[model samples]
Target: MRGALNNLLHGVRLICAVIALLAFGMSVAAAQVRFDKQPLTIETGAGARHQLTVELAVDPQQREQGLMYRKQMPTDHGMLFDFDEARPVSMWMRNTLIPLDMLFLDDKGVVTHLHEGAVPLSEAIISSGGPVRYVLELNGGAIKTLGIKPGDRVVSRQIGSAG
Candidate 1:
């Protein structure tokens, strides 16, 4: 009888451990951030327009988690970080799994600084040379392939422009 009780207790402990692990996994899934998608356009210097759909990272928590674990992003899809105001901003790719090209934009959505082909999983600091209100991150080499340059203007509803 004692042996049976011990076996039952062991089974109960195993069940509890499984439950705890499932709960932890659920919590982690719940904590993953979801972003709102928006339409954005980049008007190049020679009057060429490039359209893209981007996920907005507007809040502190969303910005903090900016594409850290994402393994892939679509060619025309990117993440746009709105800082709310123009200020010098810094970024890093500590846990990022894919290379990215970062475009720093001023208050008028004009690209001010560009950092292309940022190494994945790197902790090196990438900075906006000047104050910027937005940072648009795209797949590495997208800028050159799209012929996007520093003077290009980004138009989006969030940037006070018609999408």
Candidate 2:
């Protein structure tokens, strides 16, 4: 009888532990997208360049609510939110902390609009005046440091394809 009671108690404890772990896992899974990093090269001008590794946000939800509530971004690190088709995009820095430079790019990766020195934590609409397929949010001043400007070419290899 004693051994049976011990076994029963152990089983209950095991079940409780499993439930706790599963709950924790689900919470973590809800917080972030499963992004695949892609290699990219940004050319600002002749002989001026930067190599980057950007997170590919290929889903609509990921692209719509990009970098919004984030507090910090590493240097040379940024998020590239992608849309299935080019459309006019408007973004706001609702809960974003670190100032950013929003680069709006067309399908061909030509920078069409640049909202530079974006003020963080503001609700004002920052829009890409024309249609855009990609929005790159980088640490403030990173574009200027790389000499990136409007009409400069931005190139990216697909997430899992060889280029």
Best by lDDT: 1
lDDT of 2 by residue, 91-148 (tens): 8887577899988988888888888888998889998999988888889998778888
Q: Which stretches of candidate 1 lie above 4 Å from their native place?
A: 1-31, 161-163
TM-score for model 1? 0.81
Least accurate stretch of 10 residues (summed lDDT) in model 2?
A: 154-163
lDDT of 1: 0.91
Clashing pairs in 1: none
Instruction: Tell me the TM-score of each prediction against the true structure.
Output: 0.81, 0.74
Candidate 1, residues 2-33, lDDT tens digits: the string is: 99999999999999999999978855764678
What are the runs in model 2 whose C-alpha is more than 4 Å off? 1-30, 159-163
Q: What's the CA RMSD of model 1 in angstroms?
A: 5.4
